[model samples]
Target: MGRSKDVLIYIDRRNCDFFQNISDKFQVIFGLNNFWLAKFFIKTKYILFVLVNIISFYNNNENGLVNAVVAIFFATVYLVKFCQKCEIMEKMYEKGYNLFNENLILCRLNRGLFFVLLVLFCGMGSALICLNGLTFFVCTHMLLAFCIVLIICAEYFYACTPRPKGKSKVKLLFQKIQKKIEKIISPEPVPDSC
Candidate 1:
């Protein structure tokens, strides 16, 4: 029993580390705030799957334009929500706020979006597989399946992981950028006439 407990603890620590590392990388790459980065990593697979489904459906369907528009709308909503989340995270970070109590609310929003994306992808995949059968669509379907599994694994790792504290490399880089922007926007002090 003790050994098992130790193993679980070790696993949790490793998961947390993994989360932190990925979150940092994502922040650097996407300029997402830490809080949003956490959510993004958790939802990465679903987002990608939804995108692929949208593109595939748009390409293969008769009502291609309509499908493409709707898919684009959903993608746009996701991006907008992500931007809003990043703004909220930035405010919270500046306030030194901890989200421990609000984790459920944040998670529910994240999970709900993920669920919607999953259902959409599944429906699209099923339609393609059924209508098209074991044809060229099968290759795309297989790729989608692989991506879903990969996303599931990623979600697991993120769930097991804890949010990282302290400034990440990305945060530091952004700080520098912000400082430069501030310098540009703020007027330089006039040299003393005397």
Candidate 2:
């Protein structure tokens, strides 16, 4: 609610270059909090899916290649998650920029938690194989493929779905800031006398 003068911004190193640019532009328009990360995921997932599949296909091997495939998938997911986070944060600052707002902030935090879960699962699956040998390898690949599906679904939903709440966050924030700036510049209203 209150204007924040100092805030530390965090960026994930795994973010794609193009995504970074888009997020920056979005922030300029909306603010950081208003940025929607899932929408970006929906936008980029297909391209990412194709690239990941190509990499996995080439890297696919019969001699315990599943581990490598899973590793690559895990890494890619990490990158996507980071890019999404950056975009959402930027949007928040631009459109949903409320340092004192609780609901919107919690939503972003929920997103961060989901990313953490994805990473944990990736880590767990990978570590299980490294520690337990071939026993868990096949299972890990199954999980990796499942994660890929989830990514695709997310992308599709973001592209097609009408999320009124999300839309409002961006729209209302923009209106709020615009009115505030106008008020600041022109505080007094003129009265007409007949």
Candidate 3:
């Protein structure tokens, strides 16, 4: 498994770099305030899930308490992992979450959309299951399955898209040219004059 992961990481290094760039931008825009709010949203979402489960506990006939507990457990673990990943991004940049004012609004908007989806899906699935019979149950199950597949696809696309080789080579050459120009224009550092 570890070997496979390493190979996957190697294959997707470019996408990983792009993802890191987006994460850096998100940290700048959302800063600590929106990030913390996102955390709160996650917690509240979980609480809402638990409350729904409790309300429907007596009515559950299929997966029952077992499924509810498992779902909540997985969701909580994912939330913690998400926060840790965000923290690592901040550490990588040597800055707090609030580096770019322009990004803050975007970050908030992105997270808000995510929270809305999470609640809509989880809450609706839980409620629908208790209110009806086989049709509702199957529909909720399919919807949840679709949601999981969508998330998997999004992750893969973000982590595995490769740049065309010729385009990448040209981009590198232009970057080198830009660096050379900067070196020529900048004042030289004087040794032992710090």
Candidate 4:
């Protein structure tokens, strides 16, 4: 399985093209936020899973009630996370979720993620409040989660920065370069015979 040749190809050409067709149809959305949305959910879930394991393993010396509460809280968190991951991945590929056709979809997604940031803020507050139960590993994992989410959120928001009206200088420069390249690449047209 480590080698490319050792892997089996389960998807036939037909099924593969069908999905590729969806990708081509929503190329714009996929090119933009869908991928970042998927990344955020998957990364956040990874951290949540780690935190859950750490809480269960390291809290043996602590009060059982506190341990259970922390474990349950993390469990609920990851459960929601898994669902969110599935939802975003599902919508990302589905033709029904075209961002261009339904312009507000992206707007709604932004709003939803902003709400997720708020929820994470609340979790950070709770984690800080429960510093009594903190272990080096536990605190590190939670802080890692906070930092990872913060950085991804920053990048994702930065990606959504609004452009000013009309073609920007960078775009115009690219178009000029493209036109010159095309001119050089094309053969001269032959004179039409009467």
**Any idea what lDDT model 4 has?**
0.48
Candidate 4, superposed: residue stretches over 4 Å from native: 1-40, 52-60, 64-85, 88-93, 99-194
Clashes of 4: 0
lDDT tens digits, residues 11-65, model 3? Answer: 4454435555554444444433223433444555556555555544546857677
Better of 3 and 4 by TM-score: 3
From the highest TM-score down, the ranking of the candidates is 1, 3, 4, 2
Give a tens-digit lDDT track for model 2, residues 1-194: 13231221132122222344554455555544223544455436545544545555555556335655675566667656756654555455447454323433343444445455667666766777777555444464545555554553343222221112343357788889999999899857677873
lDDT of 2 at 64: 34
Each model's TM-score, in the order given? 0.45, 0.28, 0.36, 0.32
lDDT of 1 by residue, 1-194 (tens): 99975775566456545666776666556555355554554356446656666767756788766766786576567556755665665566567766543543344334445445666666777777787555556555555655555543344333332344456566688899999999999998988995
- For model 4, how does the per-residue alpha-carbon lDDT over 45-123 read when each residue is reduced to its tens digit? 5566556556555655557457656765765675466456445544553534434323323334443454466567557
Measured on C-alpha atoms, candidate 1 has an lDDT of 0.57
| Residue pairs with clashing backbones, model 1 | none
The backbone clash count of each candidate, in order, is: 0, 21, 4, 0
lDDT for model 3 comes to: 0.50
Q: Cα-based RMSD of the predictions, in order?
A: 8.7, 15.9, 16.3, 17.5
Assess the local accuracy of residue 10 in candidate 2 as a C-alpha lDDT between 0 and 100.
30
